[model samples]
Target chain A: MTAPSAVGISRTTRPLAPPRRTRRGSRLRYTLTVLAFLLPSALPLLAFTIYPMIGAFWTSLHSWNLIGVMEWVGLENYTTLLTDDATRRVFANTLYYVVGYLPLVYIGGLALALALNSLIPARNLLRGIYFLPVVTSWIVVALVWRWLLNPSVGVVNAMLGGLGIDGPGWWTDPYWAMPSIILASAWKDLGFVMIILLAGLQAIPTDVQEAAMIDGAGRFRRLLNITLPLLSPSTFFVVVISLINGFQVFDQVYAMTGGGPAGSSTVVVQQIYDLTFRYSSAGEASALSWLLFLLVLAVTVIQLIGQRRWVTYA
Target chain B: MPERIRRILLTAVVALGALVMFFPFAWTVSTSLSPGVGLDATPQLIPDDPTLAAYRELFANTPFARVIANSLGLAITTTALQLTTSSLAGYAFSRLAFPGRGLVFGLYLATMMIPIQVLIVPLFVQMRSLGLVDTYLGVLLPGVASAFGVFLLRQAMNSVPRELDEAATIDGAGHFRIFARLVLPLVGPALASLAVFAFMSSWNGFLWPLIILRSEHLQTLPLALAGLQGQYTTQWDVMMAGSVVSVLPMLALYLFAQKYVIQGVAGTGLK
Candidate 1:
């Protein structure tokens, strides 16, 4: 955009400023150039993301399906979502999922990162092996897990049977369903979390570790004092990103259980999907989306506020 | 504990960890290859009666071939469109100094925080209004403008030397020429990484396409696979075969370009 302004400069200093008209013209050209580059992204995003965002908020206020006359129902959708038992179950299930999933991911990711950072052979191969699941589609992953965890003929049950133990129905059991999905999710995302944390770990200066060692610091003491503190930024990144993603958890749950076992596994996004597309309740769906969005935003804001305590850049 | 024992223990743990991570994928591949194995039977990791029967069954049962084609075409188009817009926007944000630049860039970044699921209802509603539902464009349009890609490439373009663009300008080349000839080539690796990510994301995208694409033939691989899963619930081998068919290309692509993909995410976190 500023390319045209190159014409305005002179090293000789033989003349004063260029014509005000030409200067203004270059600015105009620069503005046009900027817009020209931006339009391709801006136009589609405005149409698809931005416009729909405002539309979602507006639609949340009205009982509108894709067809028929729209009826205004201010706050009713929100009120019902808050008050309804079914929606409450969905909300609580989402909470349980976040509660169950995040800790596993953080602990598992940190453990993997620490282990790999300390010592392991064939590092890239191990990293690839760990990362394999992240590449596979959630549909495939869910189906595979469903087959693995089936009560009657599943491999997991067969192994339990070998030990003279009765295995619970994983996805079909109301109590274990969310936990099972959480486990699968934890497995699916472990690689990404590990990679991020490992990157953070590797970036630590070895001299710091050696300095602690020379000072007769125990391995545990060094890790607690130095490694963990320095690793917090990556940990913070993984936690926030995964938590936001956790709120939107749908693909695996939908593909595996369809939020079944009497809605024990329904997350917020799945509820939104069912409400909008299946039941043609666009207003309710929009309300649920906004609710989910607010939840994610809140969690992100909290994390951002919390990060300064431990997430040291240096 | 001595260093040697510690190393061995760590190695064993890592091996076990990798096994835990990879076992599901191996099971899927094994099951897909070992057709007609019942869930009740003790599953064999390597079947005695290995066959392509499940694949044949998958092909016979669904228009999976067409589904794959639909997915391939949609993913490519989406990637191409995203790369174009992202690179252009990245160039502009990085190189050009214009009024309201920070505001515009901030707006774009804000949209990234809003989950794609949150936009599904209204986005679909908008598409339905425009009669884009059930069309390729309907599915493709929603994924085209990527905030991550723009931000990543902006960082990349910032790393690129401004001297090249200035030199080109001194030779009477315009901004477009500088962008096209000088800036874009320098950011080639970043674009490559962006392409891989965009392709992976569009390929794995389920929610929007499931809502938009109505026809069985128009459905992408994920949607089609979900449909097949609903139909053939207990037919593990057949479903796994279909999963394999859907997953193989991505697996190949990922293994081929693992460094770039990992680097992309790491670079973002570092920034």
Candidate 2:
């Protein structure tokens, strides 16, 4: 009887162990299925994004024209870019654009968002109207702005003249070239900023606003105290995105001014393109790109750290 | 200010701002329609002698039509590829249980911060080495795999009920079948939102195309438009006409799918 019972237990345990093995096999099958699903994106991302990123850094270390053999010159490209006055000016120009663009676009967006958030007739229509530029390509906007700000034949100065004010040579003037870029950039991006801020505004509970109202908080005071503090996340987003984009400003510069008027408006990206394609200095271009990558990464990290002091999650 | 007065004042200001914002577009259309070449001192809101001469000249003389077709074809292909890749990866990340999923998804997210400017040099080298320079595939391939699309779709897919997938699994449905038949239909809005973004980004893409496609016939709209401006700096009407042609399709798409576009943008920041 004891032998028979032991045999019965062994038989039951054998079936259970095999089932466990089957479960393990199924897990392996699941992983294979997952790989199949991810293959389309993973292959491209590895080939395009991941590999290129590493390749960029590697290429930065080597001096090579697109056509010629790569010569390993460790850190030489980076050193040249650092000491080069023209490259220095390009980075400064990019920073200047960010400094000018961030505030104008953010403020303009905040204004529009606040207005749209209010009770207004044709709200969507008004929002869409303001957002017209956001949908158009930079080239189209840049072209329009070139004509609109044409020193002689453009409508902008023409209108300014009608208002008893003389408008300066916009894209032509070295002093105004970056400002001109900022203006067009701000114009195009305001709608995007507005949409972000509007979403932020709407997320704030009305009860919070009403509570402030019941506490006798004035409209301006509520906005400054209650609204803005709560809206910091979106504001931060607008700033960070605007900064990153401002650094990469190219299409407008390419189409509108071509980084012209003595290279006053030449930014990092324009320099990168010219260095590679125009000048056939791929190593320097890669080096410059990595520098920009560092700049953007540093700024974004700073913003993220700084947000902890001001951004209220709730 | 009184409530009524404040409301009226706000309305007036908002309306004025809207007009200011819309003025450039109105001016572009008017300039394109105007008969003469350069702009006048004061822009004509409505051109006195409105004609389609610039449009006619643009389509007839230049490769504008071919450029448009190239742009349209490339954008469609890019968008389609992006959707397929993104949705599949999104389903894997959100629904499928697999080892190392978190790490892989983290990689996907991290790539979003790496701007294209950083990668362009190496990418161009890769394309050249592959002998894909001046090809449509060169312009189309790099943009087809979008990290943001995957992230967005994953977010959308996550909200889908797990019970549905489990029930399908119990009913002997495979992951692919469940993904296509069940999860996908539920995430239609996200797919649309991603589609709009993909299309817009591809259509507006300039830098890669500018670098990759050296041939005149291969030029996308933005590249061709930039070239048009370079060649005909004084031809405001034709430039504006090219501008109009470049901008109209996007505007029409935006108007038709305004909600999806706005949702895509708004969703991004909040995320």
Candidate 3:
């Protein structure tokens, strides 16, 4: 950010520089060199991201069981998946997880950011401790939480017992299974959200808050009027990222519950996995993925537009 | 209400929250060390009689050693490939002014928004067609290029002084020589950050490896650990041991390069 503008200023001021486009031989050499630099990455990205994206859509229109040749059954997969009761339930489950996850994570993240931003001893160590989960793999985290939330002999229930209350059967109970996953997910992401929000917090000018303080603004009022408004862009960033990730919550659910206890915690990506690998319904899986993509794109676009109303840029 | 009193209160609150974050990890280590067949009815922050029995069983009873080797090998390869590809492309985008550069770069960035789930089925098919399924190549091929890494490095490379490149050009150094000798050294920190991110993501990757790697001998640490959790449903000690082993490398990496990891994550969000 600092370099490009400085270079622009220097270019305008210094007039004796040689023009870049004049030499035919050098231009050809430059083009070849750029191609050489680009092709290594460009090839894999094309084969994986670009080609498979188009191929995913094309496969969604056909029926294949991964062993046989793809049979053309255009739109049938989409039509069936769209109307299936199980599909609706799984999509609804994903939404439920996102609804619970997004707010919990953001609020927790913001709270942590605010506390860490204040005058505190060992702030750096505290920040690293909170971020520990973010660096750990989802499988490990889910496994640990599964043990932690085990209904029979888990620490959480024991802690509750000490408090004279009974802890619910977390991942084991069908009713509480999704909530259990939400808790684990939110716990893992709090540090990520904290780091982003802390960066935003530090970016806010101190003079603004001091100015408010001189004007007799209390702590809460300054937080509302001066701080949060300046922090909106980071807040928007965390929300959009958390929302996109929430829609694709799989590893934890897979490891924790396996969408279990009557498929209560079954999510969209898990459904995609089940449809493709378990059921051998590759076409439906591809169709379901497309549906997920559309949902993410729609939600992200809406958030982008909505940010204009609430997100303050300074 | 007093300044010192308020500071103490704030410190206490933050410390409590930090404990909540760190407790799971502390318990995992404690449980792994505890000598028992399964979990106790009550939680124990410290085991009464700790032993290395679980870790011993984790290695003896399972293919954990092989799993770690597989994960380490794949992550190292993935990180190396990502650094080469992303740095080369990033330098080109930042320095060389080619036709349709903006459009191509924009396409790369757009691809970043599409989650990997969308490409899984077709990518599996493509790999199977190439006769590479259940092989290491299949697991590593799709992830060799990263759009996020490219963007991060481009931002880093963009900040390098152009006047240095101009002087190098005047001295008749070609683009490759200048890229190798001049620009790359200046962007070492960004490259380190990219390396860290690439290694961590590959180390933690589950879905692709689950689908592609089928053999017991070829599974990554996460895949094997999940398999262990399923195969030994009641063995909490063993499971915790596996979790600890899988997490230790990442813990070490984060501690060793703490700045790059945090900076890389924060840099992406802020930008």
User: Second chain only: TM-score per model?
Assistant: 0.97, 0.97, 0.97
Q: Please tell me which model should have the higher DockQ, number 1 or number 2.
A: 1
DockQ of each two-chain model:
0.59, 0.57, 0.60
The most accurate candidate by TM-score is 3
lDDT of 1 by residue, A107-135 (tens): 99888888877756798898888887888
Show the lowest summed lDDT stretch of 10 residues, model 1 chain A. A11-20
Which tens-of-lDDT digit does each residue in B153-180 have in candidate 1?
Answer: 9999999877776677668788788789
Runs off by more than 4 Å, candidate 1: A1-27
Q: Write down the RMSD of all candidates, one decimal each.
A: 3.2, 5.5, 3.7
Deviation of model 3 at B150, angstroms: 0.4
Model 2, A73-112: lDDT tens digits are: 9999999989999988998888898889888988889998
Question: In candidate 3 chain A, where is summed lDDT lowest over 10 consecutive residues?
Answer: A1-10
Per-candidate TM-scores read 0.95, 0.95, 0.96
Tell me the interface RMSD of model 1, in angstroms. Answer: 3.8
Relative to the unseen true structure, what is the C-alpha lDDT of residue A45 in candidate 2, on a scale of 0 to 100?
Answer: 89
lDDT (Cα atoms) of all candidates against the true structure: 0.85, 0.88, 0.90
Residue-level lDDT of model 3, residues A1-314, one tens digit each, is 11122234336434212235546665456557778899999999999999999999999999999788999998999999988999999999999999999889999999999999988999999999999899899999999999889998899988898899999999999999999999999999999999999999999999999999999999999999989999999999998988888898899999999999899999999999999999999999999999999999999999999999999999
Q: Identify the CAPRI category of the predicted complex in candidate 2.
A: medium
How much is the lDDT of residue B39 in candidate 3? 44
